[model samples]
Target chain A: MKHTLAVLVENRYGVLSRVASLFARRGYNIDSLAVGVTEDPTISRMTIVVRGDDLVLEQVTKQLNKLIDVIRVTDLGSEDTVERELALIKVNADVNNRSEIMQIADIFRAKIIDVASKSMVIEVTGDENKIRAIEQLLKPFGIKEMARTGKIALRRGPKSV
Target chain B: MKNINVYEKYDQQSDRMTGRTEKMTGARAIIECLYREGVDTIFGYPGGQVLPIYDALYDSKIRHVLVRHEQSAAHAADGYARATGKVGVCLATSGPGATNLVTGIATANMDSIPIVALTGQVPLSMIGNDAFQEANITGITLPITKHNYLLQDANDIPRVMKEAFHIASTGRPGPVLIDIPKDLTTELIDFHYPETVKLRSYNPTYEGNIQQIKKAAEEILRSYKPVIYAGGGVISANASEYLRALAEKVQAPVTTTLTGMGAFPVDHPLFLGMLGMHGTKYANYSIQESDLIIAVGARFDDRVTGKIRSFATNAKIIHIDVDPAEISKNVRVDIPIVGNARKVLEDLLKYVDKAPTDDWLQRIAHWKRSYPMHYIGGKDNIKPQYIIEQIHEACKDAIIVTEVGQHQMWAAQYFRFSEPRTFISSGGLGTMGFGFPASIGVKVARPDKVVFDISGDGSFQMSSQELATVVQENIPVIIAIFNNGYLGMVRQWQELFFDKRYSYTCIRNSVDFVKLAEAYGALGLRVTQPSEVRPAIEQAIASGRPTLIDFWVECEENVSPMVPAGAAINEILDLERKA
Candidate 1:
């Protein structure tokens, strides 16, 4: 099973490294991780996607809670969450297929962020499925480069996670 | 910052301060903070990078014990912490000195001993350049420590010191590190120790949820075969009294982990000796047959859970610990109470309904009588068990420490501990060179108590150089060496499983421990006969100086009731049955 956890931690220099080191030491698999400053500048929020059985996932959450810098850990897997991932993909495009690529990008609500004579960069923001769909479609166009911000999440209701 | 607000209040309530703020170097700030935190003793070895801190110590009232190796400093500090329940402090230089403390730090971390380790580092500019004596200690120790800090500026000293102590002494209580660069120690800043640390995310749960305690108590009442599995957490929380009360109210047999030995009185009728790999026959059997297991303050390490799937096959486990991560980490728990053991046990006793377990006690007594720990006696050869038993007879009240190996297991098995904090050893990391130096630490913490380190020959040689530290500092600790001429534990495995291939197991190398002790200007005795054991121990105690007793124990004597690796605890090989 895949689980996403929202971890609030002190915005210290090695906080990320400490969290990463724990996963490494315990041999837990991390699929994706996105970290950014929260409302409080002294605190940061990390959205981590992990794959494990229920027992392993429970261990991961409990272990993260044990870290001194970690303030809160909420498993978003069971909650109604708004998950997002940003991807900047550069594809090979010529004069002939440029219009078709742009139309497909438009259908997905993505934007053409940058362009060159023989290539164009497409910016997409969505859930993991949408990001994967666009990446698969652009693979046929010979992707030149691609970068993803992994997955960031927020709980849906007034209650904070 | 949270600290700035705290300093405002401290300034108004200035009983111990001359002024709200005073300019001082970072080195002075570190010493000042230690004084404010009530630290009177520290174990450390000085080097170039830490010269500023050591020089600052020169003018302070704190007494620093200089260990021969940085590792001893850490182990000694760990021993001090375990004995006194205070956060032990150790200082070291960069690179090798910092790295040397790794094993000891990991040892303390595994057992959840509170410690504050300070290491000197290269200046900020030289950190990544790999200058002389530079090491990324904070990075290396991240996985082992509860928390760590690398100081970027001198102004961060007061806050960092407060946080280090707060984080170390709270929660589950493990080692914390503070890496101070050379320049930071010399840099000047206004010193005002933070009065309180308000870390929003670092609040530890103290009291267990009342609902969980009620549920656990109901389960206890319903159980016919109940057993109490206690661990180091009981000792850490000082909840032995509560545990004893709970056990007496329910009449459940109590089995303890190696680290949990002294937490419960071994002589009690319901007390089963240390459980796990080297645990007693009765304790292991009790766990295997129990229907309900109340696990407190213990993580089920592999050594304790012989075959995890088959361990306590019939028991529904109720785990109580301060750290939530430890509850179901190894064994799947039914009732998990995330709180301090003392508080949880106290609340748990409220909803308890006493049940009869006379039949269960009778069964356990039968097991104890049938599978008692025993060894054959030889006419001329002095047995290691005999020596340990004799020591137990002579000094039952003494605090005992042991290095890792057969002797450690023998000490844990034979020397019964009746009081908390009396049996201190490296239970989690199983580090070999830990006992001799740790005995010094125990002695330092309790000057009125007798301290002895039961050590093996190979283990003793690893840190025997600490004898110089003991002699020079006038630490009166006794080290009883079971000199069997080999690393006995490994040799035993080889003898049983490896078709008796004694590859490198025979270390016939000759370095007389008596002469070695004498060279350090300490008393030394070599005992070849069993009769000399008692008199030697008596003389060492009466001499009131650092002493080493070298007992010539027999070879090929293995610890029995052994569960070979990967076997079920119930399928133990007893002394009468050879593998």
Candidate 2:
């Protein structure tokens, strides 16, 4: 099972390493992790995707709470959450395939952020499944390079972590 | 001087009006924080990086014991902490000195000992440059430490020190490290040690959920074959009195993990000796046959659980621990109460009554009688078990510390500990050479008590250089070396499982421990016969000096009533049965 956790931590040096080190040491598999400062600059929010059962999730939450810098951990798995991931894909684009790639990107509401003589860099933002679908359609065009900003999420309601 | 006094008075007034802020160097602030924390002694060895701190200590009252090795410093602090239930303190310089404390830090971490380790680092500008004696100590110790800090500024010293001590001594206590750059110690700042720590994320759950406690109580009252499985948490929480009361009230038998020894009175009728890899046959049998197992302050370690699937198959388990993560880490429990053991047990006592366990007790008694711990040796030959028995007979109230090996197991088995903090050994990490120096720390902590380091020849040699520390400081501790000419535990494993291939276990005719003791200006005794064991112990106690007694015992003696690795706890091999 995959669980998304929204963790609020002190925005201080070595805080990331502390959280990451804990996951590594305890053998918790992290699927993806996105970290950035929240509205309060002194604090940072980390959206972590982990694969585990209820027991492992409980342990992960408890262990993360044990770290001194971590303020709160909420399992966004059960709650309605708005999640987004950004990916920049540089595809091999020539005259023959450029129009097809543009149509696929348009259908997904993705944008062509950069264009070269022989290639185009497509920018896509969506949930994990949507991103995966677009990548599959562009696979035949040859993905020259790809960079993904791992999933960042927040609860749909007004409650905050 | 007059201007300074006036400034001091004004500073005091403003501080009293505002808070406790005093102008001092970071090094002096560190000492002041220790004084505030009521730390009386520190074990450390100084080097170039910590010179300013050493200089600051010149005017401080805290007694510092200089160890021969940095590893010994950490172990000594660990021993001090175990013996006194206070957070022990150790220090070291950068690079190799800080690295030397790694094993000791890991040892303390594994066993959950409360210790604060301070390491001197290279200057801030030189840290990542790999300057002389520089090490990224905080990075290296991140996994091992409960928490760690690398001070980037001098002003953070007081708060960091306060936080370090607070973190080390609280809830499921473990070692914490504070790595300070050399320049910070010399930098001056207004120091105010925080009166309280306000860590939003680190509050430990002290009281168990009332519903869980009620369920656990009901389970206990309804159980007919209840067994109390205790561990290091009992001692850590100082919950022995509550544990004993609960056991007696429920009329349940109690079995302890190796580190859990001394948490329950070993002489109590309900008490079953240390339970686990080399645990007593009766303890293992009771667990196998138990219907309700009440686990208190104990994680079901692999050694204790054996094959997890086969462990307590017929039992409904109630696990009470302070750490929530430990509740189902190794084994699932029907009732998991996450709180301080003492608090949970106290709450549990409110709703529980005597249990119906007469038949269970009778069965346990039968197992105890049929499978008693024993070894076969004549009067002339000194069996290691007999030596342990003699030590128990001689120093009935002594604090027993042991290094890791077969001797450690023998001491754990043979010595009857009736009080908490009486038996100190490296239970989790099982680090060798932990005993002798730890004994020094124990002696320092409890100067009035007789301290004994039960060591194997192999283990004692690991930190034997600390004999100099003991001698120079005039700390009298008895070191009993069980000289069997081989690493007895590993050798036993080879003899049983590996076709006796005996890889590198033999260390015969090594440095004579007796001369090694004498050379350090301490008392030395060599005992080869059973009769000599008692006299040697007596002489060492009487001498009131650092003494090491080398006992040449049978080389092939193995700790019996053993469960082979990965086997069920009940599938044990006794002396009459061999694998």
Candidate 3:
């Protein structure tokens, strides 16, 4: 099982390495990790996607909380939450397939951000499943390159991590 | 001139009204911070990067013991911490000096000893450039330390020092490192040590949840066969008295981890010696048969919980630990109480009622009698266990420290520890060269008590250079070197499991320890016969000088009642069974 954890830590140098290394040292793999400043400038929020069972999740959360710079950890797996990921797919495009790519992008509400003679870059933002869906549809058009922002999530209501 | 003088007087008055910050170099500030923290002694060796700090120490009153090796400094500080229950301090220069403390730091970290290790680093400008004697010690120590700081600015000295001590000695106490750059030590700053530390992410839960405590108490009362399994945390939290009270009230037999040797009175009828690998047979049997295991301050370490799947299969476990991460890291628990051991035990005592375990007690007593720790005696050759017994008979209250090996296990098995902090060894990391230097710190911490480092021929040689430090400082710690020709533990493993093809385990007597002790101006005694053990121990104590005794014990003696790796704790192979 994959767990989406929202971790708030002091916005300081080396804290990211501290957290990343903790997972590495403990033999826990981080599927995806995105860190950015939170509402408070002094605090940073990291959305981490990790694969583990309930016991592993509990250990991960407890261990993360042990770091002095870490302030809070919230597992959004069971909570009513909104998860989103952004991806940009650059695909091989020609006169014949360009229209087909655009049609697929339109259904996902994605945008064609960049276009070159041989390729077109489509930008998409949605949950992981939506991004995966769009990627599957555009695979026939030949994806030149793809970049993903991993997964970031927030509670469904006003409650914050 | 008159107006200027009046202004200066007013400024002085205001400085007195509010707490005044003193202008000093970062090196002086470091010493000042230690002074403010009430530290009177530090173990260290001076080098290039730390020269400024040594110069500052010239004017300070803090006593610094110059160790021959930087690793010894860290171990000495750790020993001091374990003995006195205060944060031990060690200092070293950059690069190799800092790296040498790595093993010692990990040792302390594993056993949860409170130690503050200050390492001098190359100047900020030269840090990444690979300057002379430069090392990123803070980065190197990250995973091993509880927390660490790289002091970039001189002004952060006071706060960093305060926080370092606070973090090192607090809940689940462990080593913390503070790397000071060379330039920062010479940089002048206004220093005022902070009185309080408030780390948002680091407040430990000291009190257990009342409901959980009630549940634990109810389970204790409901179980007819209960065992109190204690560990280092009992001593770390100073909850030995509470643990004893709980055990007595519940009428449960007490078994301890190796590090928890002295947490409960060893002589108490209800006490089962240590449990796990090389633990007493009765202790392992009691834990196996118990219906309820009130695990206090003990992590279910692999060595303690042999074959985790089969460990306490029929028992309900109540694990109480200060660190929540340790609650279910290895084994699942029935009731997990995350709190300080002393506080939780105190609260638990209020709710726990006397358990009905007479039949269980009788059964445990029967096992204890049937499987007592035993070793075959030789007519002329000294047995290692006999030597340990002699030491116990000689100094009943002495603080026994040990270097890692078969000798360490023998001491754990034979020596009777009656008080907390009396038996100190590297339990978790099992570092080989811990005991001798740590014993130096132990003696320094408790000058009134006798200190002994029970060492092995192989283990003592690792830190044998510390004889210079001990002799120079006049610390009268007796080092009993169990002189077995081979690395006994590994040799035993080979003898039992590896077809006895001794490869590299035979570390033959290369250096004469007696001569080495004499060379350092300390008394050196060699005991080859079994009868000479007690007399040499008495002479060492009476001499009031640093002494090393080389006891030529039976070379092939093995620590027994062993649970082979990955076997259940109850499935132990004793000497009789092995024979």
CA deviation > 4 Å runs, candidate 3: A94-96, B1-18, B576-579
- Best first by DockQ, ranked: 1, 3, 2
Contacts from the true interface found in each model, as a fraction, amount to 1.00, 0.79, 0.75
What is the DockQ (computed on Cα atoms) for candidate 2?
A: 0.80
Candidate 3 local lDDT, residue B371: 82
TM-score of chain B of each: 0.96, 0.96, 0.96
Lowest summed-lDDT stretch of 10 residues in model 1 chain A?
Answer: A152-161
Model 3 TM-score relative to the real fold:
0.96
**B304: Cα error in model 2, Å:** 0.8
TM-scores, all candidates, are 0.96, 0.96, 0.96
Off by over 4 Å in 2: A94-100, B1-19, B576-579
- Screening candidate 3 with a backbone cut-off below 3 angstroms (N, C-alpha, C), the clashing residue pairs are none
Query: RMSD of candidate 3 to the true fold?
Result: 4.2
Q: Where is the poorest 10-residue window by lDDT in model 2 chain B?
A: B1-10
- Model 2: which residue pairs collide? none
| Clash numbers, per candidate | 0, 0, 0
Question: Candidate 2, residues B228-267: lDDT per residue as tens digits?
Answer: 9999999999999999999988899999998898999889
